[model samples]
Target: MCTEELATWRDVSLVLLAAEALLTGLPVALILGASLRRLSRLMVGMRTVLFQARMYVWRTGEVTRRAMGMVAAPFIQLQSTVHGLCRALDILGWR
Candidate 1:
């Protein structure tokens, strides 16, 4: 082929490649924008959930601590009394 004709075909090929690239890239850009929007919303929701979970954990820990404190002395006393009784019974050969 003549150099001019070959150059013309090369130009056409380049135009076609550029057009195809634009067509392919446009949708990818749009999809990425949509994905970013969705991701932003998801992040906001996750932040709220994490905050609520942290609050719940703090409240539950406080309640548990108070409940344990209320039960602690009684529980210790009961355990010691049981131990003493067992020791006395063993000394008396009542086991």
Candidate 2:
């Protein structure tokens, strides 16, 4: 009879421990869920910002390319004209 009482007390203690663990874990789980939700929202905002930044970089690069081409145009035209004059002089035996 003493052994049966001891066994019943052990079972009761085990049930109490499990209940305590569940109570402790519930709030932790809820906090983690909320943190994940906030993180998801932050990631979405970051994605939009990054996309805008990428577009701006692409546009800047395109503008730079066009500017460089415009800056080089006169030099290219002068060189081509010089080359054509030399070719014409060579054809006429002007050396």
Candidate 3:
């Protein structure tokens, strides 16, 4: 082929290659943008779940402490009753 024809062919090839690159890159860019958006949403959801779990644990601890206090009340009352009986027996000369 003549040099002028070869140059024309090279120019055409370059233009076609650029067009193909743009066409291929557009979808890839869109897919990556969508993926990033989904990842952001997932991160936000994870943070919410973690915060809720932490609050649940904290509330559970508070409930457990209150339950223990309730369970100890009878024992405390029994001790007080026993102490009063001991004093009464001592006063009655039943040591």
| Backbone Cα, N, C clashes tallied per candidate | 0, 0, 0
Candidate 1, lDDT over the whole model:
0.96
The candidate, 1 or 3, that scores higher on TM-score is 1
Candidate 2 residue lDDT tens string, 1-92: 99999999999999999999999999999999999999999999899899999999999999999998899888999999999999999999
> Per-model C-alpha lDDT, please?
0.96, 0.97, 0.96
Off by over 4 Å in 2: 54-95
Q: Model 3 lDDT vs. the true structure?
A: 0.96
TM-score of each: 0.54, 0.53, 0.50
- Tell me the tens digit of each residue's lDDT in model 3 across 15-94: 99999999999999999999999999999989989999999999999999899889987898999999999999999989
Per-residue alpha-carbon lDDT of candidate 1 for residues 1-95, written as tens digits (9 for 90 to 100) = 69999999999999999999999999999999999999999999899899999999999999999998798978988999999999999999999
What is the lDDT, from 0 to 100, of the residue 19 in candidate 3?
A: 97
Ranking by lDDT: 2, 1, 3
Clashing residue pairs in candidate 1 are none
lDDT for 66 (candidate 2): 95
Sliding window of 10 residues with minimal summed lDDT for model 2: 65-74
Clashing pairs in 3: none
TM-score of 3: 0.50
User: Where does model 3 exceed 4 Å of error?
Assistant: 53-95
